[model samples]
Target: MKSLTNEVLHYTLFVMILETIEQYYTWALIAILLLNFSQRKIPNSQKKRFATIYLAALLLIFEVGVVTILTRGWPQKLAFLDLAICAALFYFFREKAWPFRFHCVNCNEKLDMNHIIGHDDNLCQKCYYEAHPEEAAKEEEKNKKLEPEQSSETLGLQDIPDTVSEIDWDIWEPREVCVITYLFENDQVLLIDKKRGLGTGLVNAPGGHIELDETAKEAAIREFKEETELDITDPIMAGRLDFQFKDSLSERAYVFFAHTYRGTPKETEEARPFWCPVSEIPYEKMWEDDQYWLPLALEGKKFEGRFIFDDQKMLDKSITVEEEDNE
Candidate 1:
């Protein structure tokens, strides 16, 4: 599985490199045409392409222009290559450009990107206004203003779909390293009943973000001590859970879980640690995704997956999957 994953990564990296080269060519060609070098037989389709690439290159250069396009080699070629890349990036992102075509994520159809350019991405821009008329009104107000587009309101507009049949690939996900420990005593497992914040009034495993200057295991131990005021010995490193969620407020969320906790249980305001039979877990009250995968982890399973949601901290639709357990 590791070898297969690496092979896939290598293939993806190679394709990206090839795409970059192609983009450079497209940009240079567009640049030459945009400058209108005399006596060039540029076709109408070519002109349309040039319009896309020229704009793309201009936008890309405006972004990466200052850092000296040159690397260790000759500066001139590097500059030219940079310009070409910008052009390709622009063309590659044509779905987001003007004369927009929004495709429905559920059912492919041209969406009105102009109508709900900000609020709608997963839905076809065309159908969003119809499916969500109220949201459409808000979108209309936004469009009428000719707003200069708020950066924080939307992070990856370039990745959103203007058409009805595409996916918004630019889901922002920054990775973090953390630990998970399943506190245990006899047959019962230790768990935390969260008392505050988003997942309040629910049961959870007793652990927090792995602290700084510490390994995941060390951080888990320290967090247990701080949150529960209990000393644990020999906390084992269980498996991990990779979780994600998205909503109107934020682009996405990622969380990890561990099940190898030790020591006696204690209660705290932040989280009440207790030992409960694994089978009797209140899975329904827990976050929507927990029931689907938590049990697998408790029984010692390693997993990774993407889950969609209507809100950041809450899960709406979850897809729990595992790599082939051939090993």
Candidate 2:
């Protein structure tokens, strides 16, 4: 009789222990779900993906717990429900919840697992550097310090004559460095009838000489605003022009192209702004050299050209279309 009583007592104790463990498991699941939800609020893509994965795992655990409670045993055929749940989650959340990605979002380059799971952007190293150019610039500057210093060659040395053939372009420097920016919209490009500048009475893009402590791109934006009273953005370098004139005026011009600008083009003292069809650019009214390289620029090609001009006439010219890098 005493053994029978002891058996009952042990059975009751076992049931109580099981109940306590079940309660703890329930609380743990809730805590994990709460943590997953909180992590969803984070802006980091990797953390959000992790949270999604955690939520999926918690759902599976909950399924297993329900099956165990109902059957009083480990899942058997009910294990297939876990697989179904996985499929459903994948189907529904492939873009939003998947923790692993195989390629960069920007350039579509193959990404390793470290970038997949650890980085917020999931971009490959090259794409990452391209996106964060400041960091890349810093690294480039660091590397340049380790390399040999290059000689400083002045452009259009004062003694050099006004003949293009006589100039050694590799060592040539300009007496004045300038920039020109062309803004495009739809199928029309902005052109200016120069009112008071170097190309006065001629049609050209808004541009001017680079000022002290100014970068070529900065000069392009500033000159465009000053001449057209419009702010241009995302100016891309298209080509370089080296000019030698019979009057001994040697200049190097950087050409930029932009498709975005704010404010309406207003006539300024320097220019009368007007939009001309790309198919109808008044080449005859522009600089003679424009006919040669302007078409290339319109086609998004990079070029380098040298020209010798006698006043308004192009005396001699050489143009080479540069090969673009396959980024």
On lDDT, the candidate that comes out on top is: 2
Q: What digit string (tens of lDDT, one per residue) describes model 1 on residues 1-327?
A: 999999878656654554565457556656645544321332222333334444555655643542433223233335457667766766785554432235666557654533222222446545554443324334433453453253223435344332212333232222333444556656676677888755578776656654334545466667677667666666654333433333222222222333444455567778887767877877776667677766766665654434444333443333444454574
Candidate 2 lDDT tens digits, 1-327: 999999878666655654565557666767756656555554455565575565657555655654474457543334456547666766676666555578888778888755665567777888776454334334443443453131112223454455567666654445666888899999999999999967788999999987656667788899999989999988988888888776666677888899999999999989999999999999999999999999998888989899988677787888999777787
Pairing residues by index, what is the TM-score of model 1? 0.41
TM-score for each of the candidates = 0.41, 0.52
lDDT (0 to 1) per candidate: 0.50, 0.73
* Deviation (Å) of 160 in candidate 1: 8.8
Each candidate's root-mean-square deviation in Å? 20.3, 10.7
